[model samples]
Target: MDIHGTIKIDELKKPYFVWFEENWIHDDVLHHHQKGQLVYVESGFQYITIEEKIYLLPQNHAVWIPPNAVHKTNSHSEKIKLMIMFADISTQESFYYEVNVFSVPPVLKEMIKYAEKWSKQMTVNHNENLFLKALFNELPQFVEHSLTLHISLPKDKRLAKVIQHLHNHYRNEIKMEDLSDTAHLSFRTLERIFKKETGLTLSKYQQMLRIIKSLEYLSSGNLTISETAYEVGYKSVQAYTRSFQSVMQFRPTDFIKTIQ
Candidate 1:
């Protein structure tokens, strides 16, 4: 089953890796890995497709893809990632729905390799784990990026409010009427704004919402395809898979496989 999906994590080492691009390895076809990944592209750019969204991560940037996400790594320049794999399974849920990036500081750039060595020894103790945990917490949240991506919706003020609410709550499935009442706009006006601002109808946006949520979930090994699909309001995995493929242009399983 390729359960481990790892190299150098055999008997002698704990689940951790400091892979220079040349040291990277892959697994058998059709297997998905559930492990925390911290990728740092020190020189060039790389596009990591997770759940079908292509994130062009450039130099000085790092991405954290939680376990089990269907993702792949390809470099426009040399890419080096210091990845940590945790089989304990608890770290999977710590950040389950979204991918985050942080700017690497000078110390972290050095610490990434140092920590991996310390972890392998099995002797540095919990204090080392604690330090990593705190550093993870201090990692940057791209507030500017978030604000830039979020633009104000169309002019129907009430309608705008409701649509904004729904968009932000993409993880949860919302009904049309609830949205209408919340915005104090007629369903017709809200529908128009949904189309105008997002380039998709309200119903379409809702579907996109579920897809995105599922995308994040599918990438984070914390949720299985079936579990996350249903949780995001799909009635059947087959239906979710079809729609997922239509939008993402990549098979979920295949996407996960190539990432190693």
Candidate 2:
């Protein structure tokens, strides 16, 4: 069924939790629900596209999706385990109005594990009810740790074509003049509009794409760090490591160790 149809018919009238451990290879169609959604990735990584923005949710991180905000998810992994919790709109009305991705606190992670088990038993007690309420209350604290992983796409068709070209050839040295020609706009106009619409310079956006693609390559465990670096257009491993650490706040080796 289409996502919109499923959500419209299966509206959550009360707080609930649903856990999924599956191999997601295809993308979900854009959809929205009336209840707020807090999705946590326990393993693997997922790309969530909301409106014109796409956010990467890595392992041990989570994203809060405001109620009725259109979004979709995609992943290139075989072990994507996720926990999705739903709260009535009335209860979380003031929680968030847009997607907010952040690191999951250890305490909150444990609570989510318990909530997953509790949800299956369909048992509700005073203590469990209170626990759920507390979990909901603790969500706002994560807003501060939100990551800048989101990349907003341009809406203009001409600009979008240029962006698409960058996505296709991110591993090569793309010249600004070439991009301007592709978009059929002057260099100055293209630069200004690209920054204004996406809130990132064209160069920065290309780097962001390369970094995100590197994550997928690294997760596959088939390539060495140097190979991954070269595949993502880094001429040297040192340069790639620096860029990765600058954006992710950790070395690639550290991430590999954690996942291993």
lDDT of candidate 1 over 1-260, digit per residue (tens): 33235443333233333344433343323323554566665544455655434454444556776666666543343333334423323543445335655445566666665556553344335656566665554444321121011122355455656666765776565677678778677888767765776566776666666665564455445667789778887888897888777655655574344232
Off by over 4 Å in 1: 1-157, 164-173
RMSD of each: 15.6, 3.1
Query: Clashing residue pairs, candidate 1?
Result: 67-220, 67-221, 68-219, 68-221, 69-219
lDDT of 2 by residue, 107-220 (tens): 888888888755533334566667777887778874665666778888877797888898899999988677888888999999999998998888888888888888767766
Q: Which candidate comes out best when scored by TM-score?
A: 2
TM-score of each: 0.41, 0.84
What number of clashing residue pairs does each candidate have, in the order they appear?
5, 0
lDDT of 1: 0.53
66: Cα error in model 2, Å: 1.5
Q: How many backbone clashes does candidate 1 have?
A: 5
